[model samples]
Target: MSIQLNHTIVAARDKETSAKFLSGVLGVPVGPRFGPFVPVEMSNGVTLDFIDTGGEPITAQHYAFLVSENEFDAIFGRIREAGMAYYADPHHAQPQQINHRDGGRGVYFDDPNGHNLEILTRPYGSGPP
Candidate 1:
């Protein structure tokens, strides 16, 4: 059996605001609310569940997205137009810009929840210089 990721629970001070922020960045719609959760679904059928924490301290999480070259260009363009800082590597080896590592491009940024979000046009070994 193939082991696939299920879903991740993101802590949010306000579910609606967090969901809206993510929806704007990911270019997806925030679905209906259920209990304390507001979910955003990706094109791949994965769901990101935003849970209201009511002022509780929530640790930051990192999320990575594997996208196509065209998608990366569009998303990175949006990120730049929004003045968001982005990077190529997870360790943040490079800063304030995009990286064409293994033949593809990648960028990283933070979400409203302080989650490290990344967009990569290719896999790890596929990055370019």
Candidate 2:
């Protein structure tokens, strides 16, 4: 069988809160708890299993999501409504702007755990520059 990413553990101070935050942003439901994990499953069947770190410092990680235009709108709306700061580029040089890279919209924001989250309507290099 081809190798696929089935699940990954997302370290958070509060697993439930982190899971709910991600679910609300993505407009998807968080799955029922399994042991120490509160899972948030993506459309591709890959799960982001949130685990409590019990006050441990979380090393920020970057997660990029390729979403449709409609999905991007909805998710971006939520981001703005939450007053979350976003940037057009990954380096965060351009504030309050979205990038039209590869002929699609893209933005980068940080999660509660300080993880860099990116949402783009197109895959990089998939279209004309």
Candidate 3:
């Protein structure tokens, strides 16, 4: 009886590549396409539907995921293994490092579409911000 986010469209250069890239990094599966969308379903049941920019300029956006400590470890490992540049802060002032903000570990990285992606073990402001 409450409103929930069912899905969101993510602009990308190549939908399939972006969707698969996110899936691989998050250790999730890319769902079957519905029309032009290539979806990546999260554990919370919300889906990130990736779509092409259609010859338009793709504006980069930020997307963050909350994960368990173990999940963070796995995801962070994949990020490093992929040789992706990661930062401790959203502004990317700290490279190859993670922030211990709000008493939790967090890292930021960029996707194929230049979307700033973040993974954290704790929600922001859950502790001292």
Candidate 4:
């Protein structure tokens, strides 16, 4: 059996706001509801289940995405336009710059729920320049 990620639960103070924010940034629509989860499907067949926490403070979680260069540019533009800081590293030291890790470009930022969001063009520690 080949193992693949099915979905992940994203805790949000408000599912509607979080779903809308993610849908806007990712350029996708949040469609249909399933039980307590607001299912947001991606083009890649992955779903992010947004769970409402009713203003309860949530611990920050890290989520990384592998996107094309053009997608990176567009997402970066959206991040900057939203007035949020982007970093080359998870520590947010090199703000507004992409990192040259694994011989590919990578950037890091956070979502409204304080979830660390990362975009990279290559897999971690793999591939050539």
Clash totals in order: 8, 0, 0, 0
By TM-score, rank the candidates, best first. Answer: 3, 2, 4, 1
Ranking by lDDT: 3, 2, 4, 1
Give me the candidate number with maximum TM-score: 3
Whole-model Cα lDDT of every candidate shown, in order = 0.81, 0.94, 0.95, 0.86
Highest lDDT: give the candidate number: 3
Error of 3 at 77 (Å): 0.4
Please, what are the lDDT tens digits per residue for candidate 3 over residues 1-129? 999999999999999999999999999999999999999999999999999998799888999999999999999999999999999999999999999999999999999988999999999989964
Mind giving the per-residue lDDT tens digits that candidate 4 earns over 39-79? 78877888899999877889989988888878878877888
RMSD of each: 2.3, 1.2, 1.4, 1.5
Select the stronger candidate by TM-score from 3 and 4: 3
The CA lDDT at 38 in model 4 is 91
Off by over 4 Å in 2: none
Backbone clashes in model 4, listed as residue pairs: none
Tens digits of per-residue lDDT for model 2, 5-77? 9999999999999999999988999999999999999999999999999899999988899999999999999
Candidate 1 per-residue lDDT over residues 1-129, each given as its tens digit: 988776678888888898888788767799888777899988887888999888888798888888887777777777888888777667777888787777877788988778889888778875355
Best of the two (2, 4) by lDDT: 2
Q: What residue runs in model 4 are displaced by over 4 Å at the alpha carbon?
A: none
TM-score per candidate, chains pooled: 0.86, 0.95, 0.97, 0.90
